[model samples]
Target chain A: MVINVKNLVKRYGDLIALDHFNLEVQEGEILGLLGPNGSGKTTAINCILSLLKYDKGTIEIFDQPMSPDAYDIKRDVGIVMQNVAVFEELTVYENIDYFCGLYIADRQTRKKRVAEAIDFVGLNDFIKFFPKKLSGGLLRRLNIACGIAHQPKLIILDEPTVAVDPQSRNNILEGIQKLNRQGATIIYTSHYMEEVEQIASRIAIMDKGKIIAMGTNEELKKKIKSGEHINLELLNPEDLDLEAIKALPHIISAELTDHQLVVKSGRDKNNLIAILDHLKDQNIAIGKIYSEPPTLNDVFLEITGKELRD
Target chain B: MQVYKAFFRIIQKNRSQIAIYLVVFMVLALLLTNAYTPPQDTDFTKTRFNIAFINEDGDSELVDGLKTYLGENANLVDLPDDPQQLQDALFFRQVVYILRVPKGFTAAMLNGQEVQLEKTIVPDSPSNIYMDLLINKYLNSAQTYFAYLPGLSQDQLVDYLKVDLAEETAVTVISGSSHSANAEKSGYYFNYISYSLFAILILGVCSVMLVFNDTDLKRRNLCSPIRSATMNFQMILGNLSFAVLTWLVLISASFVMYGSYMFTTNGLLLLLNSFIFTLAALSISYLIGNLVKSRGAMSAVANVFALGTSFLSGVFVPQELLGANVLTIASFTPTYWYVKANNEIANAVSFNAGNLQSIFTSMVLVLAFGVAVLGVTLVLIKQRRVEA
Candidate 1:
């Protein structure tokens, strides 16, 4: 285990931000922490990193006490927060070099890492630019480059893709995966469930001040009764077809709008095949069909109330 | 090494204004008190005027005698005008005094009727004192013709004085005293400006707001390996370097310009005096910078303290002439001591060791105030977040 946080408790006056939050990150797994706003994700991170003084907690990283002086342990952790962090006086390259210099001792090796990190984030062209001069997306990329330039063993990313363009977002997601592939353990946090489902091997769904659920994507989805989904693209399906699909024995709920009907069911949600069979028997045809497995959102909504944003 | 590097970078950005500060101090010093004749022993060569015109009489009998007397005094502005013009010259301080004749004055004096002489001046200007001695000398020498003559009426005596003698001297004396007092009055601007540098030094103005701004970005550099405390130390070092650099340049230039006379045996005394002033400035600056949260608050407090101290300490105005009971309260201000020290040193007034001790004591008090502010700032900013 690379990171171990146990029995962590934090309070701000009368309000608790983190309560007995327990989490562990194995050496090479990408653990995504998913939560709504003010769900103690930030507080947990602060406590784990020892940035904040928690009321009661023992955050042990690499199996030792963490402190401002824990150079050897801190040297292996890289964090890209939701907000950007770089000195305004420093240029993009300088900022990356500065953070990287904190870890890597060899100048030549550090230089190579910085160059590769910049290129990894598609920021080679903006290496000379300052943070203030870059667009928001470009600045986010710069922020990522600064964090990962040192190439630590564990990288913590907190909503790195928020408000970014599609291209930049895709690049960042791919880069994060690449960082993981390089044998780095990653702790990622984001409100976007699908992104977590795609990238994280282990997901922790947190709420209030504690992690209410934690599991692999497949296992988490298994927690929900629904199994599979067949999305149909049909313009103006006949009311009889929709009625027949609803009349199926396993069907739980069916929503029809915008020239499509989504039929939902229990564990064997393949009421899709039966509905199609009935549709065919009625001489009806479907345009495009997509069959997908249950996603992290289903798992998340099943575990907690479906409030997307806090 | 890291600390030094941080300080160097900060100094780099403010190099422009640093030069300006030095120049301002230098120029102000040059303009204020370069008159180096040991103010007490003013060699009368610098004096521009002298007295005596034998205004013996308008009668033909005394004309040749008066002309002969005028030929001898090189300092005299010739008195060829009528009584009014002669009197006007004396009133303007162009001549000290004039002897004027009543019509038939020689006949009256010879007939033993009467004759009168004229004089014009403020009592403090001492024009009449000199005139009195000269008149007696001449009267004893030229014969006692007008010895018993009643003097001219104050106004009529100097009718040639523009707007009348009493009228002109009143305004002139008031104006002259105001200028002299202002010109010679103590000032604390130097010390206050110095104190401001101390605040900038301790907090490191270049990085003060920058650190506050960097708090977010989520886990940014703050989560990086470097500790925030080390970063803060670097910033403090940088700011201190800039402040010290500013102080050295400003004080050196001030001395090179207005304070070169401090090189006179009394020079060290002047410098020691000015040193307190500088300390006072540095202390106040630190106090204001640390005590206030916002720049506007800092600036407001800075202005109030700097300007208020300058005025109250009698930097721009003389405390003695300002004549406020509150001045005793103001005198307790650090700036008050600083300017007071400078004034005492520059004037021929004797310097008591006790006075210097008190001035130094005030400087230390100002320094104490600065340290107190620094402590408060350190506490307020201890957590390394945006200060509330």
Candidate 2:
């Protein structure tokens, strides 16, 4: 395991930020921590990094105990905070150089890394620009560049794409994948399920400061009863029997609205075929048919009884 | 080392603001030195006044002796015995003093009878007091000789009085030199430094510290591999080096302005006092930097603390001239002790243990303030760490 957090419990006065939180990140894999705001993702990350004082539990990194003074462990870890953290007085190149210098005492090596970081973030043209002069997306890019310039073994990014524009968001997401390919174990946290589903090899769904479910995309989808959604445009909707469609095998719910028949089914491969056969038997002519696979939101809703965004 | 380098980079960015304070203080110190410096020439000359001697009594040896003595110190003017002419002469300042011998005859004084001389003079003139002293000296001497030496004739008595009064005491005037002038100038320069040093340190050190203490930036730094102790040491090194550099600049400027005096014992003490004060100011800046949240609050704190302490202490005004109550309140500020030490060093006549005791005491007080404030800042940092 690259990072292991066992039975971690952190509290802020009467509020429990993390309750028996346990996580184990394998080497060379992207573990996406998916949750809404205030789901103890950040608190757990802080505890794992030893940046916070936990009420109870232990965190081990690289098979060694983690602590505030764990310099050896800290040397291999990089963090990109939720907020942009860079010196406003320093230019882009200078900010990257300063952060890189903290880890790499060698001047020449630091110079090369800083340049690479600038190029990696596509900030070469604005290397001399101060953070205040940059747009929001460019500033977030600069923030990431400062964190990853040192090329640590484990990189943790907390909501790195929050408030970012679509173009910059794609650039950042692509850059994260490239960093992962560079043989660094990564722990990515975000509330956007699509982001986690897109890049995360394994997803951990968190709610109320605990992981409600943990699995790969396919495995997590299998944990829920929702399989797929089927929608059929009806030409003769007045003749359609909604109660009969609900009575069909593997059909969990069925509804008809605006001359379209929408049906939700359990985990069964032949649910769509059965629905289509019933429609044909009833002589109900279907104009168009659409089938959609279950999303991460569906898995979240099935397990948590609420939307992932909620 | 990276943090240390960044600290100076921030200070370099603020060099323009610091330069403005330096130039303003230098100009002010120069102007004040010029305005208060005395003239170079130190020659002495006796003051002479115009007077009229009226002889109301008949010509006698006694009257003649009095007239001759008065004529030596004053320019005896010729005036009519008429009252209107005498009044006009006195009013017009043509004669600042007038002496009239009464018609008592010579026997009144030979018989040891107390006879008064009538005189009229301008009222409230500085020369009037000197004239009175001269007259009293001559008459009192003559009376004593007549009473004690009754055997001597009037001519002999008058002659003896003249001989006795003719003997004058030698007077010497100490010429003011450039050393004392420079000392005074240096005193003013160092006293004014209290304000500039406080302002610059607060603005520069606090500004840099504010960046380092930023919540996001601090968290980022903590997450780095650098040890917290090493980071703190680098920060202290940066703040100390900046403060010392500022003090060196101000001290060097003093040497340029007031050449040889800055090397004197008193001047060296002034330098020591200011160095101590610089440390105190740095501690204060650290406190304010940690307490404040924004640049606007930093500016306000810098102005209020620097200008307020300077005015209440003796930076803009002399401590001697400050009210008792005001000094009582100002005694709490480090600047007050700093200016007090500077004043003591300037006025010191000898570099003896007794003389330097108060100066060292004041310097120690300033140092104590720095130490005390640093303690408070450390406690605050610890409390904040716990809270975080």
Candidate 3:
């Protein structure tokens, strides 16, 4: 494991911020940490980075224990915080150079790396602009550039795309994938499930200070009973047709409301052909049909029994 | 070292505020130089006031003696025949005194009858009052000496009295050094400079601190690989560099405006005194920066701590003129000791061992104040580290 955290515990007075939180990031994989606003994602990240003092458990980066004085471990780790963290006084170029210089002491090498980072974040035209002069998306890009200019082995980004425009979000997600392809293990955290689902190779869902579920999208979907859902507009439908459709193989339930038939099925089951065959035998005509595979939202809703956003 | 370099780069970005303070100091120094004129020794040595002497009494040895004494003390212009001309001469400061010898007919003094010589002068004219006293001494002594001599002639009595009342005595004034005047003047200039430096150090250092202490920036820095101790050391180094530069600029500016006389022994003592105060001011600025949470807080701190310290520390008011309670209160502040050291250095008659000791003592006290404040700051910082 490139990064491994075991049984981490943290508390703020009476509030338990992280109760036995555990996480792992393998090499060269984008491990997405998905959670709601108050989930323990940030707390767990802080504990993993040794930025906060945890009451229990261990955080190891590259098999070495993490600490504030763990310079060897810290030198290989980069973090793009949730909030924009660039210096207002420094130009974008200078800001990148300063942070890069902290790790890479060589002048010529650091200069090259800084240039690459600027190009990587698509801030070439804004290298001379101070952070306050940049738009929010540009500022967030600068924040990432500063964090990753030295090309650390492991990068942790906390909500890097929050409040970003759609184009910038795509750009950021693409940049993250590119970094991963360059052999950097990344721990990406966000509440935007689509972004995580689009980029993350493995997803960990956190709620109330614990990793409630962790798996690849397929594995996580399998953990829940929800499969593809089908919505059909029927020309003719009745209670008898609903009971026949519900009794179809692999069909969990079937209902009809306002001349529309809704069918939910269990995992890996194709109930559409079975329902269509039964409807045909009953001389039912379908006006329209639509099917949606179970999304991360469905898996989250099934497991947590609450909306992914809630 | 990288952190240190970055720290100073941020500090240097605030040159405009620092420039404003230096400019204000220079302007105030010029104004102070023009407003205060020390009394020159030559002013008293070159006095020969023009006075009109009216002789109503005809020639007598006593009257001649009086006229001769008046002539010695003043330029005896002919009494203006017109009263208006006399008034004009007096009003215009041409003659500072007017004297009329009464018509004694040369018999009153011979027979020893009481007589009064009428005198007129511009009211409140120091020169007039000065010449009037000289004339009174000359005539009264002549009469008294003659009354006792009994055998001596009037001329001999006048001669004896003149020799006895010469007004020359061995009075020596040691003004510390020939350049003591310039040293004292420079001290006055430094009064304004100390205030300027205090303001600049507070505002400049506080501005830098505010940026470094920004929530996002601070968090980002903490996440970096650099140790907190190294970062703090770099911050101190940067602030010290800024303060030393400020001191050097102000000191060099003083030297340029006041001439190389500042390199003298006592002048150097004053410089050392001010430099020590600069160190204390830096610590004060650091303490203020530690307590201040934002730019607005920095401004409020600069105003209250900088301006308030100056007012209480004899920069705006003389220590002697300050109330006892105020001085007692000021004793708690480092600026009071700084200004006291400055005052002592300015007035020092010699850069002797004792004076040096006293100067160092005051410096130590001010430095102690700085160390004490910085101690509290470090403690508070350490206490706050628990949260970090």
Candidate 4:
């Protein structure tokens, strides 16, 4: 394991921000740290990074204890905070050089690293421009560039794609995958389920400062009661025919809306032949047909109750 | 990349704050003219005289003739019915000098006997100085007429005395004053005052704003990988840079008003004064900046405290007029020390260890303030990192 955090607890005055949160990230694996707003995602990350003091916990990175003077551990850690944290007086090129200089002490090495970082983010056109001149997409890109300019072995990104253009988002996702392919472990956190589905290998759903569920994509999909959904546009059918449709084997539920028949079924839902035979017997006119497998969104919705949380 | 970006981001974010800064500066520039302009009470700088002639003789010749001699030069009030009342007026600052002629004063001058008139004066008043000068000038003229009388007839002698002593003194003194720029000698230090107030405002704004801004941003930067020491050191340098820039601009503006000789002779002294000024500015900025947590709240706190410091430190009014207790309290503010040093330096006839020491005292106080603020910021940074 590259990072291990055990039973972390944190409080602010009378309110608790984290409650016995535990997490682990193995080498070379991309773990999606998923949560809604204020669900202790930031608190957990802060505790793990030692940016916050916790009441009780053990946090180790690379199996070594972390502290203020732990240059050995800090030298390899890069952080991109939620807010854009760059100096206004400095240009894009200088911003990258400063963060890279924090690590990679050698002048020649740092210079090359910063250049490669700018090239990696494709920000060469704005190398001389100030941060205020950059757009939202470019600012997010700059945030990322400043983070990975040092090229740490383990990267933790917190909502790195928030408020970015689709094109820039795609570019960032591609870059992240490329970095992983180069053997760097990554921790990704986001509220967007589609992004996680596209990039994450392992998913951990968090709520109330605890990991509620953890599994591979397929494993998490199997954990939920929701199944593949099939829908078909149907002509008018008698009320007695609905009874026969309910009798179809492996059909967990059926609903009709705007002359459309929607049915939820089991994992191995190939037993839809009976329902189709009944539909044909009724001479129901079918216009269109479509089906979709269970997604990570379904897994999260099922595990975390459908109630708003701060 | 991080360093440069951080620098640029700060500059961009501060743009509006700087606009507000310059606006406040503009208002200060306009309103500060009140400090240098002379107080419009009365013409106290001019030698004013009240001449009272007591014509007790049946013949008004002596008093009438004396009136032409003395009254032409002085502001002749009808010789007061009561001499004691006129003397009281002089004591109460209503008149500069009072000339009292005895009942026989005019008869003696007409009889060609030596006429002695009593002039009443109040020694404790500022007008006494002008009054003495005018009296000396009058004496010299009277003596000249007596010396030249042997050459002329009595009528010519009276004519000469009236023309030279009374009428001519009026013309020469008044015209001499109007000839050159009427530089009022009273409150001459006031121009230094306007210059000093302008300089204080510069220090006040730049220092307070810089300290409050950095201390606020430190909360955010503390969580980042960059050390608290680095962040604070950079902030102090940045604020110091801004304070110095503002001080330079203020000094330049004052020099433009004071003129070319002022710029050449005192430019370096003003520049040196900036160091002390900035030291005080930084110290004050740090103290006031760290007093609060939120940036919005810090602005209010800094402005109120900075303005209070300016008022107590004699930036607008003289500390002496503000009284001894106020100065004792003002001694605690570095602005007071800095302004005091600037006065001592600019007005000094020669540069000596004493002059140097007084000027440097302010610098030392500023240094102490800087160190204290820096130390507190570091501790707070570390403490907050853990608290987070």
In terms of DockQ, which candidate is strongest? Answer: 2
Model 4 ranges off by over 4 Å: A12-15, A67-71, A83-91, A104-107, A128-135, A225-227, A237-248, A305-310, B1-224, B245-274, B286-308, B323-329, B344-367
**Cα lDDT tens digits for candidate 3, B1-388:** 7677777777777778778877887687668755766555532253788888887777677678777877876789985567798888888878878777778734676667887766678887788668867877886786677688767777787778668777675655664444767766777777667787888899988988888777677767777887767777888888889899889988887787667778777678778878888888998898888778988888787778878988998987789999999999999988888888888887776778887888799899988987887788777755553243
Model 1's CAPRI class is incorrect
Minimal lDDT window, size 10, model 4 chain B:
B178-187
Candidates 1 and 3 compared by TM-score, better number: 3
- Candidate 2 per-residue lDDT, tens place, A120-232, comes to 99999999998999999999999999999999999999999999999999999999999999988999999999889888999999988899999999999999887889989
User: Per-residue lDDT tens digits of candidate 2, residues B1-388?
Assistant: 8999999888888889888877787677667766876556577676789999888888789889988998887889999999999999898898988988889746788887878888897888998899889889988898888768879887898889889989977766654777777777788888988888888888888889789888888878888888766886888789999999988987888888877777878888888888999999998888887888888988898889989999999888888899999999999999999999898898886788886888899988999999899889877875554223
TM-score per prediction, in order, is: 0.70, 0.83, 0.80, 0.68
Q: State the DockQ of every prediction.
A: 0.21, 0.49, 0.38, 0.18
Number of clashing residue pairs, candidate 4? 24
Between candidates 1 and 4, the one scoring higher on lDDT is 4
Each model's C-alpha lDDT?
0.63, 0.87, 0.83, 0.65
Best by lDDT: 2
**A144 Cα displacement, candidate 2 (Å):** 1.8
Ranking of models by DockQ: 2, 3, 1, 4
For residues A1-310, could you state the per-residue lDDT of candidate 3 as single tens digits?
8988898889998888998988888998999999889998988887787767888898889999887778888888899999998777788998999999888888999999999999999999999898889998999999999999999999999999999999999999999999999999999999999999999999999988999999998888889887899999898776335776777778887878888888999888888888888888888888999998888888878878888888
Candidate 3 Cα deviation (angstroms), residue B353: 2.7
